[model samples]
Target: MTESVQQLVRYTRIQEIVGDVIRLRASGVALGDIAEVENTDGEVSIARVIGLDRNIVSLQVFTGGKGLSTDATVRFLGRPLDVVYSPNILGRIFCGSGEPIDGGPLLTTDRHVPVGGPTVNPVMRVMPSRMIETRVPMIDLFNSLVESQKIPIFSVAGEPHNELLARIGFQADADVLVFGGMGLIFDDYHFFRKSFEEHGVFGRTIMFVNQASDPLVERLLIPDMALAVAERFAVEENKRVLVLLSDMTAYADAMKEIGVAQERIPAVRGYMGDLYTQLAQRYEKACDFKGAGSVTILTVTTMPGDDVTHPVPDNTGYITEGQFYLHGGVIDPFGSLSRLKQHVIGKETREDHSQVMNTMIRFYSEAVESERKQAMAFELSPFDKKLLKYSKLFRDRFMNIRVSLGVDEALDLCWKTLAECFEPKDLLMKQHLIDKYFPDIAEKETG
Candidate 1:
């Protein structure tokens, strides 16, 4: 016997066709309702109900309106988009529409959960208390990545942000990794999967991919799909899930395109006025469920031409906790920040983590000034010469971007660098820390 498919009731009135958006006089249709548009050639495509004004509705065709005439048949599916949620979802890769494209069996026999719903209730959320060690010195040591934190890697085109995300997915201590690749090239998508599998983390990894050639509408769905699975993992399975969303600027571009198709008025930089709300709807999904595991989000937002004030990064900076600025092929220590790092830095990490972080950054900042003086050929003092040496050592040891060290290793390296650049009295750490952590300081004092 064959499985029966429910046939939806169809509508024939097509009022207007502008680009991929179709407008029609309709009733009993709700926003976000799934619709099917059939062209004159009997080819059908799936669309979403994006705009519903009184009785008239506007639908965005996912596959785009290519061959559809103004008289295309419209069928309201009476539902929004949903994904299959189960333990079987792990070790699987799906397209933006939640279809398994990895040559695997079709997903069945599980719950169908809606995507792009409201974020978790703030009352149910607890203060994030755990640290998610990415094992990257720029993050784990200096700026910690706390659980339930929503931060972005701010980079431009041609940067190694994808490499950074892959490293985190491979090394982060989270129980499950949910990755959403929006507008990625085929190579980047393949790299993520292959790297995860090679690093032996693919079993707990679920990927929702929207390639550059895929429909723009799909890009908007990738984040929601990934976050839905992360939520299920965190709340039900009690798993600490980390969601990695890359190239959110592409998602924003897709939203802008759809907004233009809907004839909506554009806001700042030609983006929709509600860009912040739209971004918050997805990013606010990062949460720590009470007594359960948390869902931490780390997304990549590529700035256009490295402009931070661009509308996408501008709105994103407001929504996300903080940003990791990826410039000069590295995570710039001066530019990147984790606002929630203070919550878990010393509490969850070592006894000297907070002090080491402060001392290293302060010294590195002074080193930068010393280097500028040297570049200007200014006569340098003895302290300025020491600052120059410390800065160069800091860049090579910590800021090299490829310098992958654990938090403990990074802290140890900080002391070694300080010992190389300064004497016992020159290091301004607490006396107890100096007595305990800085053996070289005591050795210098004895000598």
Candidate 2:
């Protein structure tokens, strides 16, 4: 053997096998090191070191250990997993294992970069003051998605959160889109691909998907692979990268399953105690490089049974900047918030943007109260009838997830809805904006 190949280490004994994990006595092995396991039938599979004792290492096999013998040969790779990073990867799709599954030519191995590195330092990160306009009125006008912000779409099953995610991916003004989907059905996967293709954004998009039928371990790798590539693009290429991850709940579940397989103690709801740490390690990747571009993360976190207190979303709420609450086929403005909106609302947007957002939400809240009163058979007041009219317009124009409009257009629609519902004097807005925005209303009153 060559001198380089002679230095490789191999072990042919397996101490124990449980679920998809195998335990063996091996010295000089670090956690997260990749190992190639060749079964007795001459079939090779991948495994990663998940635990380490004094002289024993526990590896989680990528391919489940169903028929493997105890004497399967283990070859340590002395490195963690990595993904391909190059401009050629654009418009390509890869599996969670970082292999090209789109029938494309195999990429050269020279550009591989390791995944799951420490996050950018605070001093290297710039303040998130820029806005990423998705053209979704509810998000752009109300809860603006700021650059380098990490947020999630809080939803339940059967909601169109995936559609909303794809819409933002294609519509958001970013230089590149990195999408990661975990445990998605085939149809949903096809839909996203078709959406990006039809909207002409596929050329600038890179997808890392793990379907429901794929290996569960691969689900855990999607976020890391996607984010790793995104970070490279933002720093190396100096491009604004938007990363959209769907169903982070599935990723957490995969971790729990692996934890169970390893016989580790479970935390709240059968999850490992380090759930928050693992999630933060990935989410902290969102950063605006000081002299380069930015990476913005928007993920879909489904709350089981629509329970906000569920561990996954409950923990996510504390880590993310804010969440876009997707319920009842729309983004509930009351439940959704952007804590960083103050950074960009009036700075990047129009001067009237802040006042318009505040006024629209206030009237919508009153409209909701009017709806409750009407439902209770209470006699509605004259102004309550106007509020009822504003509510329907707000839903159809802004709240519906399908409604897409620029920030200025949505602000104009807000003014139009308010003007059609009430006279200029009835509007409790700043006199300057009211008169400047709708001079015809003021002129009629003065005349």
Candidate that scores best on TM-score: 2
TM-score of each: 0.94, 0.97
lDDT tens string, model 2, 229-301?
Answer: 9999999999999999998999999999999988899999999999999999999999999999999999999
lDDT of 1 at 380: 97
lDDT of 1 at 278: 92
Expressed as tens digits, the lDDT of each residue in 1-447 for candidate 1 is 222223344476688988888899887777877888888888988888889889889988888877679877887776788888998988999998788989998878778898878888889899988899888888888778999999999999999999999999899998999999999899999999999999999999999999998888888889989998899899999999999999889999999999998889999988999999999998999999997889999999999988999999998999988999989987898899899998998788889998888988888888888888889999999999888888888878877666778888888878778877886578787888876777565654453
* Per-model CA lDDT versus the true structure: 0.87, 0.92
**TM-score of candidate 1 on Cα atoms, chains taken together:** 0.94
* Best prediction by lDDT: 2
How many clashing residue pairs, candidate 1? 0
